[model samples]
Target: MSRYPVKSETCHEAVDLADTLLPGNAGVTRAVVLVTDTAQLDLWRALLTGEARTSAVPVVLRRHDRRSLRGWAQRAEVFTTDERLERLHALTGGWPLLVDRAHRLHVELGDPDEVLRRLADMLADRSAVRAFLEATGVYADPALAAGYRSVAAEFGGDQVDTEAVVTAIACEIGDEGEARWVFACLDALQVFDREEAQLRLEPLLQQCMALGV
Candidate 1:
């Protein structure tokens, strides 16, 4: 297997590189392509056409400029900006990759507890959350962020505050479903007592029910 999944611009180049890197395999199913300029469209088109040969594996593309990949939003397996590549690799290449995407979203919660707390407090305050989400462009649609703020404001300072924080963060990050799951778990009051601290999760469940999650 290749040390890194192939990154190529042209179909022929990708195929040749894949064959050279993984001799026995006829082609590579998974790929990463970086499109920095519109001048590379011919190369991208060729790769897209050739990728049909191994459609089973996903071909994710990262665009350096939004204008360069505007037409490919629907075709690319996972569209992201070039600025996120390093973070993406760090998140997806390690043991964490073994977890499903939803689990990964939750796992991130443990990594940034302080940030989550701040976000939760902001969500509880409509004006603050709205300003924060709007300034950050958390959701593609500003209305979605507003909706999340509305949902979050319903239950503030409750035991589910932690879950609410996680939900608000996820919503801001465009992972609404994971946010709902976390909220649901909190509302259920499912406690997981550990040596460090007692974890309560009833607020999440209540929030989920209220949001029709």
Candidate 2:
């Protein structure tokens, strides 16, 4: 119901134009919506909370229907009137307009610890664990590697073998260069102090040699 300074066609076209102009991963920091009807209001709400992910953007909606808009204002990071569209454009540029409407409602996603805990929980599945390790490598986090080592040591055996895990950690930490050095040293040694450790490191040595490391 709020009167927009620009024509309705212009405003609608702006949405499409903004999308094409925005860069990949360039999130919307702020957004202004010029609403003309109740349907548009509902559409905006859906966009802000729908299936599409948009936790990184912020939005401001300007409308003549203040009563309805105010009802859900708290759900959004910012809210305003159609008269302020130019100001919103100035502050956010075309990029903010391209933001996922739902994502623009919140400014901060959540706490880092909460995010990490969720990640850990998500990775608990054996398939997810394998996928994560393959994607991120063994030493993605040094603390995580140390924790794995400690846990493997305490458990012992194949269930949580220290040697295999350590080799994986070394592979991750040393990369090709370090893996090659460790592998070479292990191959050269005729007698190993720890048979288990030697057995574990031998495979890594073989892998390095095979890779021509």
Q: Over the stretch 1-213, how does candidate 1's per-residue lDDT look in tens digits?
A: 123333344434664564445445667365444323223333333443343344223233221223333223224323244543333322222111111331344345543333334434534665643443233222424433443454446534233444555656475556765455433332221211112333332232223223431
RMSD of each: 18.1, 24.2
TM-score of 2: 0.18
The reply for model 2, stretches above 4 Å from the true place, is: 1-108, 136-213
The Cα local distance difference test for each model comes to 0.36, 0.35
Q: For candidate 2, what is the lDDT?
A: 0.35
**TM-score of structure candidate 1:** 0.20
In model 2, which range of ten residues has the least summed lDDT?
184-193
What's each prediction's TM-score?
0.20, 0.18
Residues 1-213 of candidate 2: C-alpha lDDT, one tens digit per residue = 335445444544555454455645666464444344222332333334442233323243322123433344335534344433333322222222222221232234433233334433533455544543333222333433343343234333333243554465465555644433333322222111134443332222122222321
